[model samples]
Target chain A: MTDGDVMRRGDFSNGWKKSFQSLEKWAWRTAVDAAVLLALAAALAAGVNAWKLRGGGSGGLPWAGDWDSYVESKALAAGIGIVTMRELADRVPSAVLDARPRELYRAGHVPGAWPCPAGDVDASLAEHVADLDPAAPVAVYCDGAACADSLEVALELKARGFARVGLYPGGWSEWTANGGAVETGETEAAP
Target chain B: MRRALRIVLLLARLALAGVFLWAAWGKIAAPDAFALAVYRYRILPSWAVNAFALWLPWIEVLAALALLAPGRRWRAAGAALAAGMLAAFTAAYAAALARGLSIACGCFTLRADAAAGGWTTLARNAALFALAAAVFADAFFDRRRRTPSPENP
Candidate 1:
């Protein structure tokens, strides 16, 4: 090839190379900016939320019984004992009342748990569980942290003269998540 | 096309930024509450929930800022990131819906708003994702045709 042709080809290639280099440099700048922003946000969030970060799900899942389960303070103050998965597994309560809605209870629940919706806590317990002694222990649960039905049911049970009312704050979600035995289609026997 | 539709693009960018900023505020304020909300989704593994919560809102903040920032580089970067986030959110919401989860959306607020994530959430996020992707594509291709800016890289 002629020197002139070679020089022209080199110029053409250099043009393309320059364009690509410009695009690549722009990309690098954008990436660096994004990285800086992410680092800043991470640092700020980590700094601001350090209190929660240290103990909140940082170590691992909120599993193993102590999963930052947001149990209401009043329930604890009212003498309701918090029941962990370990406790529930070790010693089954005499009455394991599922405080979730009937539909949810039927979907799946802790094996042997009886249907007792939160709204119908008073009447349902009275009607379905009237045969049980008031002094007997009763454990209640609902839909874990997102749910308050368990607390309501526990308080109702407490007022009903159930001396031992254990509150399973983790509820059905925790049970299923931790591979606890699940029962569907309703348990035939009342707890 | 970008030049002709510059006004429309600007408005789209603003709307997405506004949504991101609004969503980020509450989560940033209450990391613990948002963490719990993330847990409720049941889609993310138990371990990643907190870290995901911590990072997501802040990324949202960055994307919003980038969209608002001047310069074509910022615009393209912001749209790309925003599209990715919306895609992720849409997928999470769809998963929750498919799984029959009835938990709070944890979308706009940290107040444990009872408004559940459902088909509506999926649809809205899908729409937002489309907008972001469109904007991103426009920025991406439009840059290819233009001479590089003389500003320092």
Candidate 2:
């Protein structure tokens, strides 16, 4: 080949080398940008969730719990201090927390029950009773003795530094059966 | 034909990203409930449930963002990640079905009321998996064509 042709070929090789370098740079930039964006998106989502858990955002039902298995062991462990409807009525525990779903609470709950559904009790409790005195008496119940959610809430409360959490295992069924005062409306606390 | 193929791939990428983002929001909003739903699957170890519940949604958001990011490499990586996720989901669903363990899919909603079991969930995952694979393949081919070609030069 002529010297001119070789020189032209050398230029072409250099051009390809430059192109490859730019391509590598572009790939690296895209990768870093993508990683940053992804991290930002994740952080934002986690922050919002944390805010909701802390009662900063308007509350909504997290979801339903159709797959839950009512275990007898949970019921036994949950019955740490079972309260009767009579006792609950006569004493008027510091807080009456309904562990049923928000729909159930809205349908009808103990007149002053705080709707702390078991589906997302960790968040609901923060939303409903974040400021309640943990040392004070708290009563939790679910749909009925058949429903194990109340026990779950009671256990959660105890774990959260609640000093005197009680389980009313008979739940809504028992309460309504005994002609207890019932209120139906939004699940929020009374004015 | 190439142009049409590119359009279809772009649409597929957007749809996958949208679905992932939507799914991530619900799960992220209710991690505790999601964790419980995961536990019901009885697949992962007990301790892993909470951590998975906490991290999976975030990873999904990340993957979705990566899928729509501007660049073939990012999109391809994202598609591969998405494909991996769908495969994991399909396997979990299959395992649940094989064991006859009736449970919720916990896909879009954390609600346990919507018990998603059986072949339908598996089919849905399979379809999603196919789409992700297509996106990955398309991205791979597109990147190859864009690369410096000796003969073309």
The top-ranked prediction according to DockQ is 2
Model 2, residue B57: what's the lDDT? Answer: 79
Would you list the C-alpha lDDT of every candidate in the order shown? Answer: 0.73, 0.70
DockQ of 1: 0.14
lDDT of 2 at B105: 83
Chain A TM-scores for all candidates read: 0.63, 0.57
* Lowest lDDT block of 10, candidate 2 chain A: A59-68
Q: Compute fnat per model.
A: 0.18, 0.09
Clashing pairs in 1: none
Task: For candidate 2, write residues A1-191 as lDDT tens digits.
Answer: 22343354353456656755654564554456546655665576557656775788643223233223434235434444655566567655888888888888898888778888876887877777778888888888887757878887888888888878877755788677767788898645541
List where candidate 2 sits over 4 angstroms from the true fold.
A1-191, B148-153
DockQ for candidate 2, please give it: 0.15
Estimate, for each residue in B27-107, the C-alpha lDDT of model 1 and write its tens digit: 877666687778667676656777778878888998898888776677778888899889988888788788766556788
User: How much is the lDDT of residue A87 in candidate 2?
Assistant: 56
Question: Candidate 1 residues A24-128, lDDT tens each?
Answer: 776676667667777877786666566454665342222122233446445666888766565566545787888988988888988878888977876887767
**All predictions: root-mean-square deviation over Cα?**
12.9, 15.0
